[model samples]
Target: MKTPYRLILLCFVIFLTLEGSTPVPTEKTSFQWKWKENQVLELNEYHNVFFRVGAKTVEREDKNRVVMKPKKCTPDSCLVNSWFDTYIRYGKTSGPFWKDKEFTSDFTLFRNGRYEVPNEFTMPNLRSFPSFPETPVSVSDVWKLPAEESFDFNSERIRVKVIPEYTFQGIFPWSEGNYKGNCEKITYTYPIFYSKPDGEKMVPNVPYKIFGFASGTVFFNATRGVPEFKEVKLSYTFIYPNGTVQEANFHIKGIYFLRNQINTKDKESIREDILGDLIVGYTGDPNGSKLGDRIKDHNNDKEPNGKNLGRITDTGEIPRPEKDSSLEKLPVSVRTSEDGIVFSLDSILFDFNDSKLKPDAETAVAKIAEILKKYPDREIRVSGHTDNIGKKEYNRKLSEDRAKSVLHSLVDNHKMDEKHISFKGYADDLPIAPNDSEENRHKNRRVEITLVLD
Candidate 1:
């Protein structure tokens, strides 16, 4: 053990040189958003915002379906456009408030995740993790975000400067959407501090100051070159002049899923091919459908109720599909996904390898249409799928034909509006379970009609 100190020192030097020559996991490659033309990614976001104002906890759960596609690109950045279908559902709030909005917007995003969104959107949660570093970042590396920001104070508006920090938390196993590989994790946090403006004390404005913090974690899948998942929460504390305090919290979670694009298109395009167009399509909300129609004295919106309990029309009861005996007997699998309520009709709805609807399937679709009329304000999407039974190209066309058949029946026969409905075929790209067994494969070969909640 005491052979020679010089030899031991030489061995240590050799080990250090070997380690230095080998690049670290993060340093091996730079992280960038590699959005390709005709490639589409859907971000299904679920947000829960609750404010603990004194004793009451006002809560809300809203969903967003944002379909993003690369429009045009330069060497450094690209113009990304998205369709935003969002809806809000308030619980135990001041009034029964519901909103269904659909719009299209544009964004300019760089390779490092820096982006400029149009004034149409205010996505605080999406931007919780600031832009990525310009250079390669190794594990434990830290950076400071732009700290200057403005907000409304109790008495007046003010802009303050504060430091927000982001750190590289190294790589971990990431398996989401269609990609599976090592993923980089980034964590961010920022403190909230606002001293009260110079003013007199009052009951409504007694709170002189508020302070809190916001923190979250987001994952970046290097394989896909995109954000994989995100979870963020923000909290604030309001201090009253009497030394008492009130608190509020906001939480959000989002997941990104990439759609499978058609590989061959002898005639038709593989993707939507609508990326070059920028049409501001805003289907009006359900303004004509009064909330009071569904609830008795729910919002006290007497305008609709007029002389009767503030409702559009009072039947003294609530109408629900689950209560309809005839509709409840249908042989359909209804479930909820990131997209919303999905009514899945299995391959039995059609003959083997056929897109035409069976004779009995028509009756089932008609019944489903009747139920769909209840959600007139919601958007509907008809999607076709199949098992891995044949060539992908054939399956793709078959799925598309099946989806179109259902869509036409809903629109032409049932008199359903076509403006709020759309259809697509995914071949065998999406499967509820593994295609290892006949039962699972049968589940894969199904058509799903979803009510877009976003």
Candidate 2:
């Protein structure tokens, strides 16, 4: 339909206006980490500990909660105190329960992109994402992260102070509509840079350098002050002066969020979400079976060479040793021995390198005393043994002191007659296990309680 030129031109203008009214997505985006004081950030960290023996992997899961609280804040910087609240192992062969062990530290972070750590405390694989730029950034923008940081390696065998360099590898939207919501993927890489150990216990003029490499992805949420997701894989190589190379690889993954203290109406939804988290905790590593099977196959392949790389069971169903019924009857059982009816207390009864009995020791001693009261005329003997780690004389005295400590605990705390009880120490001369490995050495440290019928 041929219309007037003026009318046609008006129609074209209207079309253009309508097209322009719709918002067009921009390629550049900006984010800021303006954390406020008293803000508490809670994170669930899933750590995979793998001891790489040749090609076989002995893997286990170490899970914990990392809590961060801002202590003080300024216009451009803030001091954050972070601590591990609880540690839980997924498998049966779990390491020590670190619930009572407090590993807390603080660091200063700046708005202008400066991350500083204390000289004394260094937590490996614990770091925040690189700071965002003051201006908007596009894809393929490369930048440098904060430096002058330190990390511990091999339980303080060596320390490395490093300045990290990073390149911004573009950002993308992560998890559109889940609990994590929309997040920004901040990708970066840091090379292996080595430095001398700057620890307090580091000897002067030591001829060795600690080297390491770390690479990771950090996901940041626009509304939250902390990263919603972070995964970092760290590899460390310790070079000794005597030309020994010890390597360690660790993988750390974190899912973090802040509590919605203001949301009262969403209480039901929050409860459901928390129940879901609890289910995940019970499940342990979701992929533990598949990964454990792969490791087991690899270890089995190496068994032809008489190599026992040990079992890498599923963290979900790691096998634990069967309970011994004899040990269960320890408190009441009185076994016949050359001296008399004897009962034994292993190193587990006491703290390491201390004569003081543990809290549970009192209950055990009470049980033993109850049994001994039935045989009032029998004389009791408490003997202590030690592993061969110290001087002969010192070990002998330590054993004697430990035996006397137990004897005194029975007499003073349990009101047992001192006249019918005696104590002795056999330091390192007798051992239940070989003193080669730590487990054997621990087994060698024991105390026996013998009751004489005379």
Candidate 3:
């Protein structure tokens, strides 16, 4: 008898130790962005322009002539145009002689007008040229093929050898100026020209238009027949195949000079308004119109607008669920002399006034399943309880219903053995809290699980 009692006590101690050693469930993982929050720009802001050199081919009429006839060749005979515009507005009273000045221009032609290889060729030094300015007024360029052919025509060759040449030029003009005031008005215009063959061979002439504002003070002076030169500053830029960019600035002094100056305290405001008007006029409202807004609507039937919504993982933060020890560890039990095994049913099991198990409780259920699978001789007791929420009879029925719900979920969803499961319900008599406040009331309603060891 003493040995049997000792053995039973040892088994109880081992069971308690194993139950306490079970680990608690851990939190779930989440995703987040790596960059700083303030560094990002507003959705409406503008980004820089990206340009690429397209196909290029060159044709020569004769190989060894001082003056060669230029002809169109494969992939090379292409033209690209880029443009910028600005505006200037004067008061309604100021409508008179405002001479527009044509400033310096620049151009760069590749040897055979070919695309520049990204990392292979070194950029040409802009300082090497005397005629090129440190800044440009208006610049344009074309990539041409290399003057020499260094690669074979074999179709099987994996790599080809190619060399490129570049021709750069800059133009600086006389002057520019503006005047306002007087009743009379006048307007003048100027044009700039560019050509190939060292200024000897001429491609078609391209024109740049400039306008001036002479009003208020200069308008009166213009009525008196005053002659003046208005000076304007211009800048041009060209990009080469070797990844080098060259810029030239020219000062056409007195090209549109004015004899009088306008009198006003709102110079800066006027300038900004003019600039805004020009940008909108040319770009068709940079902020986009109603049509653009409609197009951007995700649910619209039309195609999606060009917009980068960023990654889905970066949208918002996910909240973490509450932790509960009872939901993480399994309950300990021992075999009863009458029944197979018996355990207690406490009010610390399910959520307040609810039969559904919390997310954390799922882990506890999973662990119980694992144990039952290991010990096929075990049984489970699912019991429910309620505090003093209503009459004793109603409370008892509600508790019983809650207990049945938990058992059904375990047996149906978790595929547990139905024959090994039993349930019990306790009314308000089994209150775990004082039931004084809402918080305490929540603790009074719950369903507990007890494993019976065979």
lDDT of 2 at 140: 69
Model 2, 229-341: lDDT tens digits are: 77778776655555545565667766665542223333333322322221211232344543334335435563232122221122323233323211222322234553345
Error of 1 at 253 (Å): 2.0
Residue lDDT tens for model 1, 84-174: 7664557732221123455676766665555565544432213313566656677888887554334433344334455668888988765
Q: Give, for candidate 3, the lowest lDDT window spanning 10 residues.
A: 5-14
Candidate models: Cα lDDT each: 0.58, 0.53, 0.30
TM-score, prediction 1: 0.46
Q: Among these predicted structures, which one has the highest TM-score?
A: 1
Candidate 2's displacement at residue 44, Å, is 1.7
Off by over 4 Å in 3: 1-364
Over 233-290, each residue of candidate 3 has an lDDT whose tens digit, in order, gives: 3233333324433333332221111112222323333322322221211233245544
Report the number of the highest-lDDT candidate: 1
Model 3 TM-score, 2 decimals:
0.24
Superposed model 1: Cα runs more than 4 Å off:
1-29, 90-99, 118-128, 147-163, 174-182, 193-211, 237-246, 260-454
Off by over 4 Å in 2: 1-27, 53-58, 86-100, 123-129, 153-180, 195-207, 223-225, 260-454
Q: What's the C-alpha lDDT at position 417 in model 2? A: 66
TM-score of each: 0.46, 0.45, 0.24
Q: Predictions ranked by lDDT, top down?
A: 1, 2, 3
